[model samples]
Target chain A: MADWDWDFTWEILPRLLAATVNTLLAAGIGYIIAMFLGLAFALAQRTPSNTLTMAVREAVEFIRSTPLVLQIFFVFYVGPEFGVVLSPWVAGMIAIGLHYAAYLSEVYRGGLENVPQGQWEAATSLNLSTARTYFRIIIPQALPPSIAGMGNYLVGIFKDTPVLSVIGVAELMQTANSIGSENYRYLEPYTMVGIIFLLISLPSAALLRSFDAWVRRKLGMN
Target chain B: MSYFEFLVAHGDLLLSGTLVTAMLAAVSIALAIVLALTAGLMRLAPAGPVRWVATVYIEFFRGTSLLVQLYWIFFVLPLFGLSLDKFTAGFIGVGMNLGAYGAELVRGAILSVPKGQWEAALAINMSPLTRMRRIILPQALVIMLPPWGNLLIELLKGTALVSLISVADLTFQAKQINATTFMSAKAFGTALIIYYVMARFIITPLMRWLERSMARKLGRA
Candidate 1:
């Protein structure tokens, strides 16, 4: 029985904070990948080709239903068997990015759906290409409504970044695990991980909610 | 195929692991339902310590990662002499996390049950508890089921983390078999399909049925 150790906590704070940067980088890179992939998925599902739509829809559903931790393992562990070996960081980012992309595609689908038939018709009437319609007219309108859901998943991807620790990503959770194993003091490191997540995620969630409202107002949709 | 041979060899282990995963999902989801209702009610309580406590629980559980929480409860609580087996810690970690999210859905559903219903119950001189029991809760339950279905799936996925705690769930079994056989594709692939089946064929349809039955019972079908 050891009591709470402040001295040990101070010694470990810098190490934990240093690893927080890696965690942020992993999440940041993963979020960007998800954003692009999710939009592609959302668009793929809406294409005129029924087969493509069905395939993409099934892909998204399969991804969403399965556990992300397993997906991370699959990508990292199984990739080598197919001669598609990737580092832990690369595999982790792809797996998590793919998992959240499934969720984000749904969010995008909802936003894209909310854009009226009139917008499409008007673009057609104006003789605009599909690309011009999406880029110049529709996507901007779709974006404001999507912002809140997108932000939630952004926070979601961050929370899920810890799963990457399993693959030796050296992110916050993995770093904390090493610290605990090294010092044999699980309490401080684990508790601090929880605290760091709360401190980062809570305010960001709040900010995103307000930002969503602001965007909606700015777009005159609300 | 090599995968079929692998399965033929290790099918029993995978089957047992699937059973463990199912058990974990069922127990944790049950716990989550109870906790969600309790906290949801507490959240709607007029401003006070109860509401404050519920809010804090929801925020803390929702804000942090479940893996971190599971590690804390399983790894740290023993230091304070409150040791729990992996299953106990596993379900608690997931149940609490899901409950926090479910609490919001519960509150939202209850609040969504139009204002007039509460006013009407008040006009009829119904007690508050009776109003909730007889009037509000029944309606709110139907509204909440679809979202609760999603949460249940999330709970099922989250149980994978219990493997990290060495719970011998489907994921752990897959990992173990992989270590020995070095057949990562077959092991993890089978595990993924089993999970997908559980989610889509089992949990999703089951939830859809419940939602429909509840709607019919409430005369809203």
Candidate 2:
């Protein structure tokens, strides 16, 4: 049986810390993509074109229904066959981005739906153009309620960055796996990964809650 | 090979894989429900220490990724002389992870019960247990069902990760078939479709039926 080794833990901590930076970078890029694409998906569902709405809705459902790792494999492996090759980083970002976009779109849909119909009527009465109404009025109202959900997914995408390791993205999980294989020590690296995640997620979750309330108060929506 | 030929060849393997996935999901969800109830109730406990334990459990589980948790259980535990089989590790890892999320849902639902209901139970001189079983839980069950539906689907998707630890689930079989045949689209595509059908058609409707029946039982249908 193996016992814990403090010296080895100290030695690998720097490498793990470097991988953590990559993990955060992956999460940040993925989240930026998800936020915009999610809005597109959410708004597409509300469009007057039945085909567009159906297509976007189906796409979201399909993505949500399937596993992220499978999608990652599909894109990374199968893309070259279709003449759209990508780097591991690009492929990982696209897969994770799209997967979470489906979820974030759902959050946006709920927020959009929560806005009263009378608000739209009021905007119409005020002679606001469709784009103006959406950008100026509806979006501000929609955002306060969606902040908490959006924040959850922010942390969610962060935690899920580990899946990119499967595609050899050099994120924290991949780094930890390699470290484990190299030293034949699983205990330290895995525990450190969990600790890193908890340390970030717990504080961010609390902050998001407070931020949610702050947004509501700031918008005077309550 | 044609898709039909592929199905004829590997259909049984995939089906058996599906069964394993289902069994993993079932065992994990069953265990999760038990854990969620205990922790949820403990979260409402008057004692600070008990509540703190429940909070820590939920936070630690919720904060980490399920894949990491599974790896820790499957890989790290053996170093400590606690060797678990793939199934047991998958079961515990997934169960505890989902339980943390479910416990929050459980706590939220119980708290959403109206204050009047508790007052009325008190007025009727019912015991706390009786009041909970009869009055509070029924309504909370209805409130809990929809989110539980989402969690169930999430748990079902999470079973795919168990493939990493050499569990013979659908994802593992997909990888195996793809490696041997080099049929990336055929193998992985089929796995994706199977997961879609199971989640969208089978498990989803079943969850809806459960939710509806619970609502009907409470005359809230």
Candidate 3:
């Protein structure tokens, strides 16, 4: 059996912690992109134009059905051929951000659907512009219900950050792989990565669930 | 060379890759269902430690990254004198991960079976075990199906990660073909289409059919 070395784990701890910062940053930026892009996708699907609705629906289905890793590979490798050379960081952000956007769009759609039909009618009767109706009235109502799903994806995107390591983004998983190769001990680095992920994921998931409940209560949606 | 020419050369490689992906998905999903049922039952047990064990298993798997879990089994387990072949590792890793999520779905479905049904089962002098097997599970299976369809699709997408472990799955073949011909678009693009077709055309319809049949069994159709 391979022995676990305490000394080796301690030596690698600092580097792994540093790489954790990169992981958090990637998840943050990717979430921001997903939030906005997903909103745009959700709104696009609701437009009066049948063509726009159908196109957006098909696009969302395609993205949701495929794997994120393949999408990352496609953008990173295939982009150069079409005269678009991006750094691994930018490429990873775009690919992951877009992939999650498709999922978040569905969540947004569910939230949007939950808002009663009368709310829209009430907005129109009050002479509010369509934009105002959505932003000031309907979106606020939709958001409380959306928070739980949004939180799940937040954790999901963070967990998926390691996949970015495949394209060489120097995240936790890549760092662990390098450390293992250098020290000829896979046990320490890999185990360390799992514990770190568990530590971050479990607490964040709990926090998000509470936050979701809190948002619903504050909005009188409970 | 053009993308079409690249496809022409690598078509057989892509097809074989598709086959591996299908096989991997089939194996993992079957294993996940069994684990889900066992864990789901444990979660509802009256004993405290048994319930706690189920909770820990579900949360632990659900909380961590599947990639790390897969790598841990593939890399670390071997160091500990339990070296699994790639297929076995992939099966255990993905199956266990999906099992955690599926257990929750199973629990939810079981709980959704109305309370009066349990009372009625008790009145008929049925044992708790018989009530679950005969009365509760039949209804829960239909209720469990729609979400299970989504989980099954997620499982299919997850199988792509097995390629990272050198499983010669569809994603691996795409990479191999790309390496040989440097036709990144054709290689990855073909793989994408094949995946889309499988999810959209085959797996999805099959799940829907299963769901409908299960619903009919409960006389809900």
Q: lDDT tens digits, residues B47-102, model 1?
A: 79999999999999999999999999999999999999999999999999999999
Model 1 lDDT vs. the true structure? 0.94
Write model 3 residue lDDT over A1-222, tens digit each, in one string.
898899988999999999999999999999999999999999999999999999999999999999889999999999898988989999999999999999999999999999999999999999999999999999988988898999999999999998998899999999999998997889999999999999999999999999988877787765
In terms of lDDT, model 2 sits at 0.92
Tell me which residue pairs clash in candidate 1: none
Instruction: Return the top candidate by DockQ.
Output: 3
Q: How far is A164's C-alpha from truth in model 1 (Å)? A: 0.4
| Tens-place lDDT digits, model 3, residues B1-221 | 77777767888899999999999999999999999999998999999999999999998889888999999999999998999999999988999999999999999999999999999999999999999999999999989988898888888888999888999999999999888877888889889989999999988899899988888887889
For TM-score, candidate 2 versus 3, the one ahead is 3
lDDT of 1 at A26: 92
Q: What is the DockQ of candidate 2?
A: 0.78
Better of 1 and 3 by lDDT: 1
Off by over 4 Å in 2: none
- What is candidate 1's CAPRI-style docking category based on DockQ? high
In candidate 3, position B12 carries an lDDT of 89
